[model samples]
Target: MFAPFAPMLRRAALVPSVHRLLPSNSRSLYQNIIKRHEDMATEHGSPSSSGEMHDALDVLSSESSPISTIPLDPDTDYAALAIPSLQSKNKANLPPLMNIPPQEDPLLHHIASRIMNHGERAKASRTVSQMLLHLHAWTRSPPLPILRQAIFKLSPAVKVIGHKHSTKMIYKPVPLSEKQGIWLATEWILDAIKGRQGGPTLAERMAREVILILKNESKTLEKKEAYHKSAMMNRGNIAIART
Candidate 1:
């Protein structure tokens, strides 16, 4: 008798949970709930596998991006125009990395620092190194000796100064200290480099000029001569110049 009553006992235990899910229902309401559950079971049979989920995602991605492409011109990049950095190709195709720089000599460092502008010291250092390499190639000898010789030959002894004398500017020949002389030499050399008509880079132009300086053919030499002549002509004003 107990065995026969087991199914009825289980059904009676579920009655409370079914009642909680539905309003106080008659026989027809219970039948409708069962029919709805059966329909739902048929509609959504089982959970999706990982492969099925991935396929769905891939299909969605393909549909959303059927013709993906990147624009060559940044001006036409409508996507990231608002961002300042990406607005221009400022991050594109930079120059190759510079070779080992000549930084052992303090004099060389000082010259490199002068060559550097706008805080870009790396380029200056590389240019200085290139100058050495060029010197070596031209003379078929150690570069340092030639470099020192050029600097010594190119360095000027005196700099011209002007004094206000009775509504006239009187030029004075002022002897430059070692420091002043080196700085002035560097300035003049750089100025000459800038004035050169042809050369892709400062290093090449400067190297060519240094080689010419060695050969006594550079405009830097001419400039030095002009300064000396001016100083000689204005030697009278030397008395007025500060001691």
Candidate 2:
């Protein structure tokens, strides 16, 4: 009888009616909160847990990539750190020619004057002469020979002051011919004047400043030369009239 009574008491203790039960309101409230949260998630079309986790991982990975890829320490960029020095070294190593000042060719002034004085004739002469100067400067060639060669190349209509008027004496102008020749000539002479070339020394760069000044006076020089020429032509006409 005692054993059966003890077994019944244990069974009663385990049963819900004999136990301290959860309040019905509390249980209902908890269930409602869980269901409401599920409904709200469904209404909002929120991503599932696994999807949310994957998205977060993707974001984290993207943010971390650049930081991990690039070096944090400035010193670690050996190439970047050395770049300024390398550039300086390279600049220093450049040929002394590039650093040289512009050349002072007296011929430039003389040629310029000839151009202004002669107008069409002198202009054409100046153009050809300047082109020749460029060549002479570039090749370090002897002045008179280049001048002679250039004169030979001019059109028959384009005559240097002393060139023969014969058809056999004139040379034709080729297309794209003057372009390269002029470039080479200008750069070469500029280098030579700047002391880059091993040749006969030219006037100092300071003296070259005088040429620039004269270049400004080119307009006045033109008027004087024109007046002189007109007077001479007038005298020639008067002599012819008397005859």
Candidate 3:
């Protein structure tokens, strides 16, 4: 009975020692495996078994090729992107002078120059000259038939006021010539520029007078058109006068 009990007790004592050795061996094996993985990761430019493979791949790819690492648009214009500041610099470096032709008419050139330099009198003078020149061109050497017709239209009607019952009308023809018409037009323009005797002065009313004189519906322009229309209607007079 004692011998059997002794074997049982020795086996029970060996079981605790085996359990203690098993834990130490398993821990050393696990540490060795972890160290081996770290060494492999260092050699291959990757991370250990810590789940950092994606981050390691990004770093490795960026370090391999720097140009390809940055994302760029396929249609991007690299040259335009590189020197954006040069465009403004080139514009600033251009010469200030411009190419323009000189005015042919001396009076027109003078007026334009003065207007550009903000001369007050130049504008008034220009307006007067322009109106006069236009009127002169239209009225100069008008057909004799047209002149007679215009005069007839302009003739004043004299009404004879009789005492009892009879009433009569007399037409007085106003003599008009192309020279006279041109002279009157010039004088009219001058008066407008100078303003009325009791009205505004040239400095105060020059612009207003200029606008009125140069208008298409002006009295002077209406007179010119009336003359032209009257001439057209009396074309037969032109043939008669030539005879």
TM-score each candidate.
Answer: 0.52, 0.18, 0.23
Best by TM-score: 1
Candidate No. with top lDDT: 1
- Model 2 poorest ten-residue lDDT run: 154-163
Candidate 3 C-alpha error for residue 80, in Å? 68
The TM-score ranking, best first, is 1, 3, 2
- Which window of ten consecutive residues has the lowest lDDT sum in model 1? 56-65
lDDT of 2 by residue, 1-243 (tens): 588699889976665431134455755565566556667777788748445544543443342322336547755878887999999999988866555544645435443443343356556454545555655565576654644343223212211122234654332222223443333333323443454455432323312322332344322233334434544444422223353
lDDT of the candidates, in the order given: 0.73, 0.44, 0.47
Higher-TM-score candidate of 1 and 2: 1
Per-residue lDDT for 133 in model 2?
Answer: 63
Off by over 4 Å in 2: 1-68, 74-84, 96-109, 118-243
Residue pairs in candidate 3 whose N, alpha carbon or C atoms collide under 3 angstroms: none
Give stretches of model 3 more than 4 Å off: 1-185, 191-195, 203-206, 240-243
